[model samples]
Target chain A: MRKRDLSQFFKDKRVILLIILILASVISISTIGIQEGLDLKGGSLLQLQLEKPVDQDTMNVVTTVLDKRLNIYGVKDVKVRASGDQIVIVEMAGVTPEEIERLIGSPGKFEARIGNESAEPALTGSDITNVDMYEITGTSWTVPFKVSPSGAQHFAEAAEGKGGEKVYMYLDGKLIDENPPTLSPELANGKGATELTVTGGANTVEEAEAQAMAVYTVLKTGTLPVKLTVIGSNTISAELGEQFLNGAIIAGLLAILVISLIIFIRYRRPILVIPIIITSVSEVLIVMGIASIIHWNIDLSAIAGLIAAVGTGVDDQIIITDEVLGKNTDNTKRRKTRTRMSVKNALFIIFASAGTLIAAMLPLAYVGFARGSSGIGTISGFAFTTIIGVLVGIFITRPAFAKFLEIFIK
Target chain B: MLEKFMESYKLLIIIPMIVVILSVGLIAFNGLNEGIELKGGSIATIKLNEPIPSPVLENQLKTALNVDEVDILNNNGNDVTLEIGTEVNPASFASALSGKGQVISYNSIGPVLSDEALGQVYWAMLFAFIFMSITVFIIFREIVPSIAIILAAASDIIIAIGGMSLFNIPLSIASVGAILMLIGYSVDTDILLTTRVLRRREGKVVDRAKEAMKTGLTMSITAIASMVVLYAVTVIFIPQASTLSNIAAVLIFGLLADILTTWFMNLGMIRWYMEWRT
Candidate 1:
């Protein structure tokens, strides 16, 4: 052969040696399981964009409060972190959607009042409603509601003799302010509208409006001093989760069976299928087991990654099959050497491709840390498990592929 | 014999043309759907305290958000995924949900994130290209032959992306990953052809091309068979066509095109390059 016709990289049968390395890598990876994420295991992915651009201080306070609340729901593997601008992400394993709603719902409001005086309250704002606002004077307002009929009559009789005495308004039973005495008003048909006026407090229109809404919501829910609006809510049915889990298991098992058949048919030998099955199963199992050990929550995305890995493993096996068959071709003397060369080249491509994909997924998995992007933890888990599978494909499974190929072809 | 051989090579150029035409036509007629990731939108979660009647909250989400294009999915009984349309603004989305039920959490990915994603996609493609060029040169070590193979791979990628763009399969991060995968697959096939030809000495360049073509064609068909089956199952299992599915479609197309080009067009070019140099 002319000097120019020779491959620079092919000197000293380097390709054959590289094949051995590839086989070693695959075998090594087979012993280790890749880590899975929350998506694969089934968890909640919650994205919370702030209502307003709150400074870091408020966010810290909210985070602490939310963390405690999430922990209250038995979410031990919970991740609460900040995203870009004014968003927060929370991931918890085995979290039902209902639990998420409760955690993210608005804190409660509490208010209390008694005749001309009041006690502190412990009810939420949702219980309150029917707030009527009346203009008392220029730039002044009075708002009140007939406190749920029972409290109304009780306060009415309490004020019957206490006319000209100051009446106080309380939220969650805490005195908001006490209004100075007004003229004794005539009771219509011996009944009166239970009312209170913010005589000289509240400072601005916004404050007055807020106080009235809070008071109304509290009275409505009949519970507390806070008004809550669910910014985001999702409920995953246990039935659906179970179905998904079943589907994943079925799909996985079917894939294994199909791949095994493929190996047996192509190689025309049962022995060739053994290592492929072992390597494939080991890759997935080890990944899932490690994920459980790490307490990573698996979700839907992680399932997708798992399936993708399954397909990739089969593809790798096909390459091994080609090398094995190529090794035993026309020139038996060069079979070992050529088999090694083919495996090396194939592994090189697999490594490069897997590396590129891992790099891409890593940033996306972490994207949840930035505000706006959701599914951070779930994406991370999927990526993590995927990279693990690819690593095994390169390190353990592929090397084992070479060894197995060597055995079967011989 | 020579005429028969020339006829074999002609099919390579013809097949890719047919694929390009079909891909273009399909993408043109049936527009692609854009996911919320690329376009701005709101995805809200609704939690039912108890197992409510007709547990799927799609209706409630529509009523709460007052939008009909909402995707209300049953999550693991306590939660429903409410993927509302892009028509709703982030502030209004919060307000609308707040008006009805308490919002548990709401996420809005801005137009900027999509832009950044787009920028990142471009960067990835660029990196893949530069890396592929260097890797191909290093691995194959023949300038003209390496360039020929790279050109075929590049053509497959461009045509795939173009097909995706024309089809309006909203470019996504996941799709980018798929395109990279297609690249590796296409290049591998090309290298296989080059390897068989480079190692052959019993025949002319065209003869080697035909010999490689037989094996390359078989590999491509087998791979496509598996991919088609997988894609079918994926479609049936995941009715919602996500980015991953879109990538699968691209891969199938690119792989099919690659087989045609590598088994013939690439072979012709490499043969020509070798003959001219000598």
Candidate 2:
């Protein structure tokens, strides 16, 4: 090959575009960041199937109530949405599945009864306006709550003549406080006092704090409208999630290194191997960037899909390289014609294979979406990431690599 | 060089054909072992602060939890995986393990949902196969070559499944994704072989086949190399990535199977078709 203008080659639009895209992808990945799924980040995912099918409004109510309950539990990154007519999906980051089950598993019917256990509830969670923690002593705490106007009147009347009697608290038909607090004689004439306190039953400050917080959460967010059965739940520990993140990064880097070594050994030419490996690596980066921009969650399956995409990507690059550089016995004139034909043939196979791969993964993505929050939902992340990676390879990275090969390869 | 064996292509294809048939037979008779995700069950991984024997934990789980089916898998020396049937309660199950170790992760699925999931997985595989076959037929537009491509893809899946059964890898959603992906990977090399052998007329048939083999082998080797790295990393360093490890395992097996089905079986059919056409 004659001496080509290297600077002009750099000026080619495809190469310039490739460089710009790589830079943009790096920036996007650093700034926006890809979302990690529960598997990659320690969290909990719960799929709740309702007792009966409900309308859109009821579903909305359920979602709102659940969302409020999780928020009250101080789970900031909680997502609760209706999947179908009878299913609700709840996802919380940095929380255990057991914690989620405890918080939302029951209807949380919190009531405070006066006099006897069989007596009617003087104040329910719905009658409470606000719930807050109060320090009763050095290590003891109480959950003080303010009732609504009508509830305050009912409570005062119930406690008017029963100053020494106990005011019992029950949550879901089970008495939460074993030793109920007795009414004081200071306000015995039914003077409606809205503020009341539930004594904490714990030995340490931390335990009292936790008990107060649980009570506050239940009182703040009213009971769920319908019963929910947890059909599926997945929880990962924070330590394990961090380990997976680090391990995945190392594995990805090693995979790229090994793949580069293979290509180098096969081609035995830096000119061919460098572009191939660069294209493959760039494909991964661009996919991750797109994932970051779209806020797609990168779980283990998605990571697997990303690797699968790069694997096929390397395969396509090999095909292109072999097509352009494979030996031919024709004369110089026919050799030039053969190289051009081979590139075309290689592209045909690349596109055909790309089509088949996309076709194969289509059902995985579609079925996951169509099934709502069922079994395939978890696997959908893999399918979506794979499709995205393949599409990026065919549309952006592969064409750019072809352009580079055309400019550089002899 | 390969032309000498062209006459024996029929004989060479018989080996893989029998393996495929036996694989189908095994799957039909014994059936695939479904994972907890596929069938409704519970799986918990406990991280032991100290070392404990597997048998000790197993007996404790059985006695304390009263679970009918409990399998304790000792991963490394510190982590133990408990697989229990759906009869076990998730809350109590966690408490039962807490006495011995800290529960690192837990997954539970109800029977009704898992049944629905199983159905979805079957349909997904079926649809993926049909779609891939259609794409291959469209690309080739020839009956023999398209069938060869589809056959190779099918054989890869069947053999991969058989490998899974032999290796005791349970069929999960991750493995299902890998199998579907195998269809894609299998078709990739088959397309390259068919296109190079049937379309290009630069040299003798064997020479063209040999050239295709060089490129196809490189492609397969690179893919296999990457998967090997992935599998090794997951198995050795990252035990939490069990799902991805399963996927990598399936892909490695399928890719190896693809080499035989593509070069031996698909190549045989393509060579016969080319010779008959002339």
Candidate 3:
């Protein structure tokens, strides 16, 4: 066998694709940045399940109210995301799960009073039938809402002879609107109106819209449309997360070193170990880059997925080395054309194996997404990362490795 | 000699089957423990500042929390993971620690959620296995060979579960995830052997099978080596991440089972199917 020069290797499409993807991954990794998952960064993640699914509008109210409540409670750096139509995932750092549970466990409370000195509330959150936010009017934004018949009656009684008095709005017993809408004379004449508006003026249209949205959120957040059950919760302390991250790094390096040793032993060629290790590492880097591009959290489960993927990547390389180079070792019987034939065959095996692995992972990923960042979060991340890893191997890295093995032939 | 090995293929095939049966029996006789993830309770990982024996920490926690049931999932030196029968808030659980250690992580699942987790695990594994079976059939397109591959994968999982039961590895989402991975990964050797023997025309069937064996054995060995190392490192450095160690352990067992199943059972079946076809 004669040595094939480097130019042909660079000219190969497979090698070129691999290099381009690796570069793209590096660029994306630098620009977009890979965000650490909650598991690694040490945060509390709560999966709140609604008793029943609600419309998107209701889901919005659920998230917005949760965000407002946490902020009002002086909780900083909180993120509330709605998953599907029913689940709400709330994540925050430096806050205990117990504190978050205590905060969101109860429904948001809204109270209306004609005066701050009054003891009893004239209206509660349940009194509001609907809050409409789609309509906006000029620099002054007005939020229209319908009140229950009973609520209209209580409001009329509370506002009777209280014209020009400011109606105070409170959410969870904290003052929301310091300068509230004043009770109109007509409404103060002891007649109840089911229709009402929380109107305010702002210097900018954006401010006006924001003001209306705030009031709407306060009112709608008054009571959840459906009961929320804390289905699952986990809290990882910051230092522990740091330790886990470090542990993962160490474990990964050791695994690679040991795997390389195995490859070297099996092939009995130190040079082959270099390419195998490079291809394997390239698979991981590409997976992480894709994860970064997609904003996937590189969590503990995901790291496991990376390992599984890299493990499979090594397996594929082994297959290629054996089929392409092993048959070549029996040089007297097999020809160059035969070696080329098995190379294609080796790739077929890679594709078939990768196909089945991805097939197996689909359901796990689906279930994880269905569970929405809860206890199954670990499993789901494992599934998703494994899928991505296998894909990168079959599509990019394996082909390059196969192409590189060509130089060993002829 | 190759012909003699072929004549005794039945015995070779029976080996993996008997292993699978015993694995089934082992799993049944020694039921795998349900992980806290499935039944709904609380598990707190504590990084103990000082070394404490398992019993001493267990007693202190039981008395401090006044909970009758407490199981230490993992206790590796200063890193200890404890599972409580019921949900305990972080405050009381922290105070129960009595300054011995700091809680690294805490996970709590109510009873209802545990039930949900179990249900999800069932469906996910079921569908994954089904999809994998379908993929294998689609790849091979032959009934007997496809069945052989599927059977090998099933046996691998059963044997792996048996290993889990024997080793006291609980059936949790994490461990179950490892089992599902076995379906995808351990089936590769079966795919290679079946494809080479049934689909390729380069050499004699025995020679093709032998060739495939070389490639397949290397694949399995490399995969197994990586898992062994991963399991070792995980157990040593980060005992708190028992999830990883559990996954690595399950994979190692499954891959070992796969070597026997794929090489003996699957290979024998494929060989018989190939001879019968002619």
Using DockQ, give the best candidate's number. 2
Q: What is the interface RMSD of candidate 2, in Å?
A: 1.0
The lDDT of each candidate is 0.55, 0.83, 0.83
Off by over 4 Å in 2: A1-5, A134-141, A153-163, A183-191, A199-207, A327-338, A370-375, B87-91, B275-278
- Inter-residue clash pairs, candidate 2: none
Which ranking of candidates, highest lDDT first? 3, 2, 1
Task: Give the CAPRI rating of model 1.
Answer: incorrect
Expressed as tens digits, the lDDT of each residue in B93-189 for candidate 3 is: 8889888888889987777668878988998989998999899889888899889989999999999999999999888888988998898778788
Question: For residues B1-278, could you state the per-residue lDDT of candidate 1 as single tens digits?
Answer: 64364455446445665665666566566655555555655665545456444433566656766765776543545544456665354445555544444344444445544455455556556766676677777766788878877777777776676667665665555565556556656665677667666754656766656645654554455445555555555555542324335656776777777766676677667666655777
**lDDT string, candidate 3, A324-374, tens digits:** 875564553556667777789998988998999999999999999877777
| Residues A142-239 of candidate 1: C-alpha lDDT, one tens digit per residue | 55544455544544555455445444544533555555335255531235445534333466776565444443333333331222333332223334
TM-score of each: 0.62, 0.92, 0.84
Per residue, candidate 2 scores C-alpha lDDT tens digits across A17-109 of: 778878888999999987888777888888888999999988998899889888878885898988778888898887776666767776778
Clash tally, candidates in order:
94, 0, 0
- What order do candidates take by TM-score, descending? 2, 3, 1
**True contacts reproduced, candidate 2:** 0.83
Better of 2 and 3 by TM-score: 2
